[model samples]
Target: MEDTMALQNDLTPVVEMKGITKHFPGVTANNQVTLKLYPGEVLALLGENGAGKSSLMNVLVGLYRQDEGEILVRGTPAEIHSPKDAVQLGLGMVHQNFKLVETMTVAENVVLGLKHLDFIPSFSEICRRINTISRQYNLQVDPRAYIWQLGVGEQQRVEILKLIYRGADILILDEPTAVLTPQESGELSRIIAQMIDEGKSAIFITHKMEEIKRFSQRVQVLRKGETAAVLETSKTTPSELARLMVGREVLFRLEKKICCPGEPVLEVKNLCASNEAGRPSLQDLSFIIRAGEILGIAGVAGNGQRKLTEVITGLDRADSGKVVIQGKDMTNRTPLDLIQSGVSHIPPDRISMGIVGDMSVASNLVMKEYRSEPVVKRGIFNYKEVAKSAKEKIDAYNISTPSQNTEAKFLSGGNIQKIILAREIGACRGLLIASYPSRGLDVGAMEAVRLQLIDQRNIGNAVLLVSEDLEELITVADRIAVIYEGRIMGEVPAEKADIKIIGHMMAGASLKGAAQAAAEAELGEDGI
Candidate 1:
C-alpha cells in the first residue's frame, strides 16, 4: 500500500475540481467543494444522501454546470457542457439506474451514441472489440445477449463495457454493487482492480463502509455539501468514517431484546404468482410470521421478494395461493381490504407507491385514515386534526421537513423515508411488511430505522422484513428465510444462521443441499 501511494503521488491527477459550488432551490448542493482523482487509483466518495456527492459528480459529468468553480482534466481547464463533451474528454459515468435500451444487444448498446459510427456500422467489429475488453477485464457477458436477457450483474458489466468502449479512462461508478449478489460484488472488485492495474482511475460513490475499505485507496467523506475528511483507507476505520460523514459518533450495533413470539399473524400457504412478464415468480412459497417476531426475507433482488410482497399486500394478484391474516383467508383481496385487515406495507419505491409527492406532508400522513373519524367527519376532512397528527408524527420520527404543509417531494430521501415509517408504523395493527427499509440511508438514519423495526417486533407486531442487506436482517430479525426464484429455500433462526449457507440458498440451493455441499467440500479439503 505504501509503495502504491508513493507511485500515485508522482502522477498528475486525471481529473480535478477546484472550489466547485452548485445550488438549487433554497439550498446549496455543493459549497465550494473540491475533489481530485489520481491516475491508477480508486477514490471512494462517502457521504449521507443529499450530502452533495452526486451534485459534485454531476458537475464533472456535464449533467449540471457549476455555479462557482473550475474543472481541470489532465492539468488543463476543460469545458464540459454536455455528456458528449464528457465522453470526448475520456470521462464516463455508470449511473445507479442503468441507461441501456432493454431490447438492444450488448454490442449495439455499446456503440449507440458514438458520432464517428458509419451509416451501416459493422456489428461483427463491435462484438470483437467488446470481446477483447471483456476478456481483458474478466467481464464475462455475451455481446449478443439482449439487456433484458442478462442478470443484474451482467447488465452492470455491460454498462462498464460501454464506458470502456467509448475510450473512457476516468470512470465514475455510482453505487455499482447495490443490486448485485455477494459473489457478483466480489467479481466487480476484481474487475475494478484489473482496470486500475491498467492505469485507469475510478471514483466510486457508495454508502457501504466495507466496500470503501476493500475497493479504494483513499476515502473522501462529505458532510453538509463540504469536504469533511479525506483519509487513507488503510489508516482509518469504519467507525471513524461514519463519524466524519455524519459529524457525530455512530452506534453500529443496537440493543435488541429477546423476542417473545406469540400467535401466528401472517400465513402464506402454497402461494403461486407470476411476474409482470407472465412468468412464474412465486412457486408454492409458504411462510408463517408470528406476532412479536420479525421474519426476514433474504435474497438477491429480482427474486420473488417483490412479488411475494405485492401478493400479500394486495398490490398484485396471486395465481393460486392462500393468504391468511390472523386466521382469516384474505387471498386475492384488494389493497383496501388488506389494510382493513390490519396489514401495513412500507413499499420499496417510496416516492411512487408509499406517498403521493404532490400532496402535503400532513395530507400524506392521514392518507390511510382520511376516510375515518377524527380526520373525516360528516363527509368533510378536519384540517386541524390532520395538522395535529402530522405534528406529532414529525416530532416523534425526527423528520426534518420545513412544515407539515410542505410537499413530501421537497424533502430529502431520509426524511421522506421517515415519513413513510411514521405513517405505516402508526397504522400497523397486526402485520407490517417493510422492504429494504434502511436502504440508501446514512449510518445515522439507518440506525434509526433499524431500531424502529426492533421496536415494532418488541411491541408484538408481525414484521416481514425483505432486504438485500444480510447484515441488517441478521441484526433485527428473530428468524431469517432465504428466498430464491420465488420459493422458500430455507428458514433458520437468525441467531444460528450461517452466512455461507444463506448465500448459497439465495443462489438457488436448498438448505439440505447446501449443507451437504459444504460437508463434501470440507471432506475434500481434509483429503478424506
Candidate 2:
C-alpha cells in the first residue's frame, strides 16, 4: 500500500479528492468518490444527467460541503470551506450558467469579489491587466465592454479571463460548450490545448463525448455519484466510455428516416409582434410549418424569439398577418382559442410560462387541461380526478419528485421542463413549439428530451423548435431557418449547412447571400 501510494504521488496530481461523499435530504450525491487531476493535462469528467457530476465539482469548488472526504493539493490535505477558500487553493470554476453582472463592464465583472479596489478604481490599469492576461491565455475579450454588449461566446471568454485574472492554475469548466456553435467549440478546444501546453491543469466537466475525444488526455467516468472508471482517451472510444458511464450500450444517434410532410399545419404571413417595451419585436415575419416536419428557428436570444412565441400562442396578438392553423384562420386569437386549436407551447422561461412555481406539481401538470374531460366535472372542480391524472403524467414523464403534491419550485430545472414537456406534448393535437427545451439539462435529461421531441415529430406533429444552440438545430431539425433582427433570413436543409456559414448568419449576416459567398469561396483560386 505504501509503494502504491508513492507511485501515485510520482504522477503529481494537482488536485486529489479521496473518499468524497455528500448527501442531500433524500439523495446521496457523492458516494465515496475519488478523483484526481494531473498538472498540464485536460481531465474529462464524463457522466449522464443527475449522475452527480455537478455535485462533485461543486464540492471541490466549495459550493457544497462534503459529508465525508479529504481534499489534497500537491499531495497535501487542505480544507476548502467557501469559494474564497477554493480560490486561495488555486481552484476556480466556470459554471454552466455564467454569473456575470450584465450591467457591469467586463473588467469590473472579472475583478469583482477580489480585495483591493484601488482608491480611485484603476479602470485603465485593470483593462491593461485583463488584456495582458487575455493575450497570455489566448482568451481575447474587450475588458472595457459592457457584459450585455458581448455575445455568448465572448461572455464565456470573459468568464475564463476572470479565473485567469484570479491566478488560478487549476480550472474547472462545467459544460462550457453547451451554448457554443461548432466553430466556437473548436476555438475553445484550441484554447484548452494551449493551456495544457503551458503546463496548466484543467478538469473539464461535460457530457459531450466528442469533446472528451478532442480535448482530454485522460477520461474519468462518474456514475451515480461515484467514479466508475478512468482511462486514457486514446485507448477508448465514445461508445466504450458511454457504456461505462451508463452501464450499457447507448444509442448515440436517433433512428430517423425521411418524412413525407403534409399540408401546412401552421401558416403565418406578414406577422408582427412587440417586446416587453411595446416596441416592434417580430417585424413582418412569415413562415410555414408543415405537419411531419421539424422546422428549427435559430437565433440569438431576445431577437424576436419571445414575441413570435407569444403571438402564436395568443399571449400577445400580432399587429398584422394571418395565423392559419389546421386550415383555419385563428388570427389574433385568444389564448384559449390557441389551446383549443391544438397548439401547445413550451415557453422560453419554463418557470414563468410553463409551470406555476408556487403551485404543486400535480396542479401544474393539469394546468393546461383543467377544462377538458376527466379532469373537469360540469364546471365544478374534480380534485381526485386531477390528482390521479397528474400522477399518471408524472409516472409517464419519469419526473423526479417525492410526490405529485410537491411544489414545482422544489424540483430541479430539468424536472420542471419534463413536466411542461409531458403536458404540452400530450395535450396538443397538431403543433408543438419548444423554445430552449434542453437549456440547463445534463446529458441524460437532455437526451431524454431530445428523443421525446423527435418522437413527436416522427408521429406527424409539426414542431417549431426555437433555440440558440446550433448543434441541436443540426441534429434534430430537418430544416433550419436563420432569424435575425425580427425577420427570417432564409432556410436551408440541415445537411447542407456548415457551422461557420450559419454562425455568420446568426451574427446578423444575410444567409442567402452568405451561403452564395460560401459556395463561391469553396470553388477555389479562379472562383476567388
Candidate 3:
C-alpha cells in the first residue's frame, strides 16, 4: 500500500475531472464531482441506482456535456464534444446495454467509425489486427462471428476489443458484470488485470460491493449526486461502503423465520418447452411450490429460467406435460386463466413486461383488478375508487412519486419496481413468481423487496423466486434448485447452501457430484 501511494504521488493522473456538474430537467445528475484515474490502476465508482455515477462518466466520454468544471487528459486540458472526439483523446466507455450492430461481424463492428479507414476496408487485415489484440489482452472472440450468434459475455469482449482497436488507453465499464455468471465475472477480472499490467487505466462503475473489492484498487462512493467518500479498497469493508452509499447503517443479513411449508400450490410434471427458434429449452422439467415456502431457481442467465416462468404463467405453450394449480390441470391455459387462478408474476424485464411506462401510476395499479368489484361498480368504471386504491398502495409500498397520476416512466428504477411489487403482492392469492425482483435496485430498495418476499412466506403464500444472484437466493429462499440446460441439477436447503457447490451445479454438475468434488478438494487441502 505504501509503495502504491508513493508511486501514484510521482505520476500525473491519466484522466481527471475537476468539479464537474451536470443537470437534467428537474434533477442535478452530478454536482461538482471530482474524479481522477491514475495509469495502470482500476478505480471503482460506487453509487446507488440513481446516484449520478453514469452521468459523471458520460461527461468524461462526451456523451453529455458538463454544466461546469473542466476535464484534463494527462494533465492537459482537453475538449471532448462528441464520442469521436473522446476516442481521439484515448477515452472509451462500455455501457450496460451494449452498443453493437447485431447483424454485423466482430471485425466489421470494431472498425465501423474510423475516419481513416477506406469505404471498403481489407477484411483480411482487419481480422488479423483483431486477433493480435485479442491475444495481447486474452480477450478471445471470433472476428467473423455475427453479434447475434455470440453470448452476452462474448459481445462484451467485442466491445472492449473495439476500444483497444481505436487506441483507447482509458476505459470506462458501466455495470460490466451485471448479467455475467460467476465464472464469466472472474474472466473479466483477469482481462482488467491484463489491461492494467499494460499501463491502461479503468473506471469500473458498479453497485455490487463484492465486485468493488474484487476488481478495484481504490473506491469512490457517490450519494445524491455528490462525492461521499473515497477510500482504498484494502482499507474498507462492505458494510462501510453500503452505509456510505445509502447514508445509513445498511443491514446485510435479514431476519428470516423458520419455513413451514404447506400443501402444494403449484405442480409441474414432465413439462417440456422450446425457444422461439424451436430449440429445446425446458426438457421434462418438474417442480412443486408449496403454500408457505419460497422456492428459488438458481442458474446462469440464458438457461431455462425464462422459459420455465413463461410456461408456468401461461404466457407460452408447453410441448408436453401438465401444469396443475390448486389441484386443477392448467396446461396451456391463457394468461387471464392463470391470473384468475391466483398466480401473480413480477417479470424479469420490469419496464417492458411488468408495467406500462406511458400510463399513469394509478391506471397501472388497477390494471389487473379493474375487472373486479370495488374498482368496477355494476359494470361501470369507478375513477374515485381507482385513485383511492392507488394512493393506498403507494403509501403502503413506499413508492416515491409526485402524484398518483404521474407517468410510471418518469420515476426512478427503484420506485417503478415498488409500484409493481405493490400491485402483485396485493393481488397474490395462492402463489407469486418474482424473477430478479431486486435487480438493478439500490441497497435500501433491495432490502425492502426481500422483506416483502419473506412477509409473503410468513402469511402462508407460496413464492417462487428466480434470480442469478446466489447470495440473494440463499438469503431469502427456503430451498434453492439449480437448473442448467433445461434440467434440474439438484436442490439444496438454503440453510446448508454452499456457494462452491452451487457454482458447480450452475456449471452443470449434479448435486451429488458437486458435493463429492468439494469433499475431494477439502481432503487434498488437508493432505489426506
Candidate 4:
C-alpha cells in the first residue's frame, strides 16, 4: 500500500466508490469493490478479460447501475443515473472504442452535447481554447480536421480533450493504448503526467502490465468480478501481477522454430477496391504471403483494412487485382468459393463478418460448412450432427458458455473471439486471413489465439494477420510489413525490428532509405 489515504491529506478524494456490486443474469460482474481516487494520482485498474474492471467503471460512469454501492464525489454521495449526470459531476470517461462523429470537426466533437445559444460553436473561440488546452496538456490535435482523417491515437486525444473541455476533474480511460504505436503511447504518458500536475485524477483500466509499471502509482488487480489485490506499482513486477491476475504463471509468448518460407501461398497484386461509400479503398495494393509464415499487416483503421480482407476473401469485388491462392486464381470468386478452396477468414467486424448475434452457437459453428456432408444433405441441415460438432469445438476451444444453444451475444468479448477462432482456425487449410483477431480478448484468450495462429503456420498454412495492436504483431508475427495509404511501405523481420522504426513507417514515413540500408541485414536466421 502507498498510503493513498495519507496522500489525500489536504486534497479531497475526487471519487470514492464503496461496496460496489453488479450482476448480470448468470454472472456477477463486480463484488464488494471499494476504491478511492485522490486529487492528483493515476490508479491503474488491472485485470484480465471478464475480470470486472470495465464493470466497476461502467457503474461509476453510469452505463450500468450498481446493485449496491455508494459513489461519493468530493466526499459527498452523488446520484449519477446517466452519463450526463457523471459529466455534470466533473467525471468523464473515454471508452475503449472512441465515440466521435466522422463528419464532425475536432472542436465540434469536443463541444458536442453542450448547450450553445448560437447555432455555431464560435469557431475562432473554440479553436483558441482547443489550441491552448492542447498546449497546456501536450494533447496535440488539429481542431479543424475531420475526425475520420486522424489516426486511432489522434482520435483518442480528441476524446480526452472532450472530457477536459467539459471541466472533468476525475477522468476514466478504458484501455487507452490498446491500439497505439509505441511513440504515440509515450506521448500519451506525458499527457497523463501533465493532467496530474494540473490537479486531476485518472483511472486507467488496462491489462498491460508494462503500462501499469510505467504510469500508475498504485495498482488494483481485479479477478473474476472482484478486487483480488491492490499494491503499489513500484513494489510489484509484471510476473507477480500476472500470477495474481491469472492465478498462475502465463507464458507471454509462443516458442517456435524459424523456418524458411515455402512457395508463395497467398499473393495479391495491384489490388484496387472500393470503400463503403463506393470511393476507392485500396489503390494498387500488392503483397505476397508465404506458407509456414505469418505476414503481419500494420496500418491505421480504414487504410483499406476491411477492404483488403474483402478483396482477398471474395466478399467485395476488386476494381482490378490478382489474388492467387495455392497456385489457383481466386480473384473475383464468391466468399463461399474462397472458403471451399481452403481460405479460412476471421473477418474484422465480428458481429457482421464472424458471428450472427441472434443465431445459436451450433447454427453459427456450421455456417461456413453448410454445403459439406454431415452438416448438409439434400438441402436439409443435420441439427444433431451440427450440435455434436459445435459441442466438440466449444469444449476444445474452451468457450465458457452453458450449451450449444447459447446465443453468441450472451457471451463475453473473449468468448466471442474464441468462437470465431474455433470456427475459422478449425476450418483452415491453405490460408487464414485474420483481422484484429484479439481485439477485445483478455490476455489469456489473446495468448490462446496467438498460439493457434502459430499452430497454423507450423502446419504450413499462410496467415495474413491485419491488426492495429502492435504488441500482437510483434509477439506472433514472423515478418511485419507497414501498410500506409493502401500500399506496402516495407517489410522487416520481426526479430530485427524496433517499435520506433515500425511506428514511423505506420505514420506514413517512407521506408525506401531503411529498406535499402537493411537489404543485407535482412539475411540470416532471426526468429520472431
Candidate 5:
C-alpha cells in the first residue's frame, strides 16, 4: 500500500464523493463524508455497526439519496437516482442479504430484469454466459440450481455474478463474508483478488480487521457520521483500528475465570429430530451442560445447531430423546413448561422468536414474568411493576431508546440483542441456552454479550452457548464441543484450545484424528 501511493496519484479516481450528508429520523447517518476510489484496488470501509458505512454505500449505489454531495464517475459528474441508473453507470452493490427468488434457477435469476438484453433470452445461452463469468471471477455457482437448494456461500456467489453480468466494474460489497464459513470466506478472498487483477475496483464495507489487511490496500475509518482517519491497511494494527472505530481502548480477548461444575442442569440424551423437509437434523445427540459453566457448541451454520437449541428449549419436537432439566424429565414439554422449569432461551432468530416487534418494550420485557408474582397479582397484568423492571433492565443492558413504550421493531440489531440478553440472563433460574447471541453485533456489543454470558456462568447457571465465531468459543467457554452434521464430533477444554484443531473437527475430522493431524493441518491449513 505504501508503494502504491505513486500509482494512486497517476491513475484517475473511478469514483469520488465530496462532502456528502444524510439524515434519518433521529440521527444524522453521514455528515460531510468524502472518499475516493481508484481502479484496480479494494478500499476497505471500516466501522462499527450504525457507523454510516452502509448509508454511504447506499448513496453510492442509488439506494439512498444524500442530503448534499457531489458524485463524480470517471472524472465526470453524475446523477444516480435509482439502482437502474447506478447499474447503467457501471456501479453495482452486493448486499449482506441476497435478493433472489428461492424457487428460481441461478441463470434465470441473473437474467431476470435485463432491459438492455433481448426481449426473451435463450436458457442455454444464459447458462453459458453464467458459466463463463463465474469461471473468470472464481465464483462457481451452478446456473441450473435453485437458490433455496444452495448454501449461504453459494447464494452470495450468485449475487456477485448478478453484478458482473450487468456489466459492472465498480463493486460495493456490504459485509460479504458475514454469513460465510471460514472455508467459504477464503474462496471469497480469492474471487476479490481476481476482480482486482482484472482492473476492477471494489469497496468492501466490513468490520473485520484481518480481512482489511489481507484484501484491501487502503482503510477508511468512519466514526458516528464523519471520517475519523484513513490509513494504509498494511501499516495499521487491529488495536488501532478498533480504537478508531470505538473512540476508546478495546479489549481483544475475554477474561474468563474457572468454573466449578456442579450437578447437570440440562441433559439431552439420545435426541433425534427432523428438519423442515423431513430430513434427519439431530441424531442421537447427547450432551450435558452443567451448573456454573459454559459449553460452547461450534460449527458451520445449518449443522443441527438450530435443532439442538429448539429441542432443548421445547420449541421443536424431538422424535426420541430425554430432555432432563434439574432432575426432571422435560422431553416434549411445552415451551411454557420449560420456562416454568427455570430454562431461559435466547433463540437465533431474535426478532421472531425472542420478542414481539409491534409490542411495547415494557410489555416484551415482562413477557416471561407477566403470569408470575409481583407483576401479576390477579388475573390482570401489572403495568407499573412491568415498567419498573423494563426501565431497570434497559438501563442495565445499556439499551438506547426513547422510552420503554417504544416498539421493539424500532431498535437496532445490537439493541435488540441487548434486550434479549438482559431478559434471559436476568431471569435464568437453572439453565440458559444462548444461540448466536452476538451474530450481527459490533465489537463493543459482542464483548458485552460475551461478558454477560460469563457473568451468568459465574453466578451458578448452566449455559449452552452456540456460536459460529471460533475466537468467541476460545474466549468465554470453559469447554468447546464441535458439532458437524448432527452428532457431536468431540469436546476439548477451552483453556489453550488450538483453533486449527477445532477447524479440523468442524470439517468432520474425529477428535483423535484431529489431534493426530493437528501438526499437518497447521502446515497444510486444511479444514479451515
Candidate 6:
C-alpha cells in the first residue's frame, strides 16, 4: 500500500466543497456534504442510487447550485455560475450519457461547443489537434471517424480528449464504464492511469466496488444525501464500503445446491423470427428447457437474443416453427395468453417493456393478475388487496421506495429491477424467461437476483436466462448455447465452457470452425 502522506506530499486540495446542501421540492437531495479533491489523485464517489453523489458533483460543475455551502479552488473561494465558468476555472465533467452529435465526425464533435469557434476552422487542423491530444493521453480516438461508427470505448476517449483539449486540470466522470466490455474496461483503466501520471486529477462516480479498489486512490461513501465515510483505498474492504453506503452489511455470495433435471417444460422447434426492420433475427432456432434446469443463451449484444425472448414471450411474432409448452402449441399466442398459460417474462427494457413508469408501484405490481383474483373482484378494483400484496412483495424484495403509492419512475434502477423480479419470480408459474435480469444492478443486488433464478429452477420451474455477460452465464446456467447472426453456433456444457469458442461463435463463425479455431488458438498459446 502506498503511504497516504507520500501520495499527498505538499499538494493542497485543488477543489473543495464545505457544508454543501441542495434541496428540491419536498426532497433534500444533499445535506451538509463536504468533499475534497487533490491533484494527481483519483477519488471514488461511492453510494447507492439517489445518494446525492451526482448532486454534489453537479454543484461543482455548475449544473446545480448549492443552497448553502462554500467552494474553494486552490485555497481561494471560487464562484461558478455556469458550465463555461467551471471550464474557465479548469474544471470539467463528463456526463453519464455522452453529449456528441452522431452525424458529425470526431473532430467536429470535439470542437462543437467551444466559444472560440467564431471563425470557420479547417478540418485538417482540427484533426491534427485531436490526434496530438489522443497520442499524449493514450486515448486512441480516430479523428476522422463518425461518432456513430465508433464503439462505446472509443466514444469515451473522445469525451475525455475534449476536456483535455480544453485545458481542464480536474475531470469528473459519471458511470464511465457502464456500457463497456471487460477488455474495454481494462483499456479505460490504463487510460485513466496515464492521465493521472500526466498530473491530471479525477473524481469517478460509480456503484462498482471493484473499480474503487482497482482505480481510485481513496473512497468516499454517501448515504441518503449525507457523507457517510471516507477511507483510504488500501485500508478498506468492499464489504465495509457497501455496509456504510446502504446502512447494512451486505451478503456477497449466493447459495446454490446442485439439482438434477426433469421433463422438458419448454421446447422450440425450427423457430424463425424477424426484427422490426423485417430482417431475420432468429433462424432455425431449436432448444428445450427442462424442469429444474436453466438454459443460458450467451451472445454479444444485438445478436437475436431479443428476438428469441420476444418470440417465446409472445411480444413478437414468429415467421415460422412452433413453440411448445407442456405439449401445447403456442406459435402466435398473445402476451396475456402466454402469461395466463404459466409463462412469466422479465423483459429486457424494464422501463418500456416491464412496467408502466407513470403508474403507481402498487398498480404495476398487479399488472399481470389485475383481471383476476383478489386484485379485481367481480369486475371491481380492490385497492386494499393490491396494497397488501404490494407491501409484502416490496418488503420481501428489499426495494427502497417512499411508499407503495409512489410512482414507479421515481425509483432507482436497482429498485425497478427488484419490483419486476418480485412480481415475476413470486408469481405462480412454470417457465420463466429472464432477459438481462441483472443488467444494471449492484454486486449485492445481483447476488439476490441470481439466487431467485436458482430457487425457481430448484422448485422444478424451467428458466431460460438470456444474457450478454459470459461470466454471469457460466455462473448460473447448466448449459450454455452460443448464438451468432440469428443462428445457434454451438452448445457446450457450462462446466467445461471455453470463452475463446464462444467469442468466435459471436463473431459469426460456424460451429466446426469455431471449435477448430479455439483448439488451435489454445495450442499456439502453449507453444505446441
For residues 361-439, could you state the per-residue lDDT of candidate 2 as single tens digits?
8998998888877788898889999888898888887786767877887665557878898889888688999988886
- Which prediction has more favorable lDDT, 3 or 5? 3
Per-residue lDDT of model 3, residues 1-528, tens digit only: 122355677889998899999987667878988888888889999887678887888899998999999999999999989888899899988876688999999998998878654455589999999999999888899999999899878988998899889888899999887657667888988988887888899999876788888889999888888999888899999989889888888888999989999999999899999987999999998889998999999999889998899998999999999999989999999999999999999988676688999999998888888889899999999999999999999888767566888798766566777888889988899989999888767787788789999999999999999998998999999999999999999999999999889988998999999998888888899995
Clashing pairs in 3: none
Highest-scoring model, lDDT:
3
Whichever of 2 and 6 has more TM-score, that candidate is: 2
Candidate 5 local Cα displacement, residue 376, angstroms: 5.8
lDDT per residue for candidate 4 within 1-528, as digits (tens), equals: 234345455666788899999988668888998888877889998877667877788899898999998999999999988888888888899886577999999998988877633455588899989999998888889999999888777998999889888889899989888767556778888888888888889999876777888888888888887888888788889888888887888787678779568999998988887766778778888888899999999887767787888889988898887999998999999988899899999987675467898988777777777888788878898888898889888888878665788788766656777899899998898899999888767677777789989889989999999987777888888999888877777888877777666766777766765554445345533533
Candidate 6, residue 140: CA error in Å? 9.2
TM-score, structure 4 vs. true = 0.83
Candidate 5 is scored at a TM of 0.89
Cα-based lDDT for every prediction: 0.87, 0.82, 0.88, 0.83, 0.85, 0.83
Total backbone collisions for each predicted model: 0, 1, 0, 0, 0, 0
Superposed on all Cα atoms, the candidates' RMSDs to the truth, in angstroms, are: 3.7, 4.5, 3.4, 5.0, 3.6, 4.5
> Which order, best to worst by lDDT?
3, 1, 5, 6, 4, 2
Question: Clashes in model 5: which pairs?
Answer: none
The sequence of per-residue lDDT tens digits that candidate 6 reaches over residues 286-355 is 9999999999998876678888888888988999999998778988899888888899989876765788
**What lDDT is obtained when candidate 3 is compared to the true structure?**
0.88
Which regions of candidate 2 are displaced past 4 Å? 1-9, 101-108, 115-154, 257-260, 272-284, 298-307, 314-320, 327-340, 348-364, 370-387, 401-416, 439-447, 458-460, 467-475, 484-489, 492-528
Better of 1 and 5 by TM-score: 5
Per-candidate TM vs. native?
0.87, 0.81, 0.89, 0.83, 0.89, 0.81
In model 1, what lDDT does residue 10 have?
A: 72
Candidate 5 least-lDDT 10 residues: 1-10
Candidate 6, poorest ten consecutive residues by summed lDDT: 1-10
Indicate the residue-level lDDT of 4 in model 2.
22
Q: Which ten residues in a row have the lowest lDDT in candidate 4?
A: 519-528
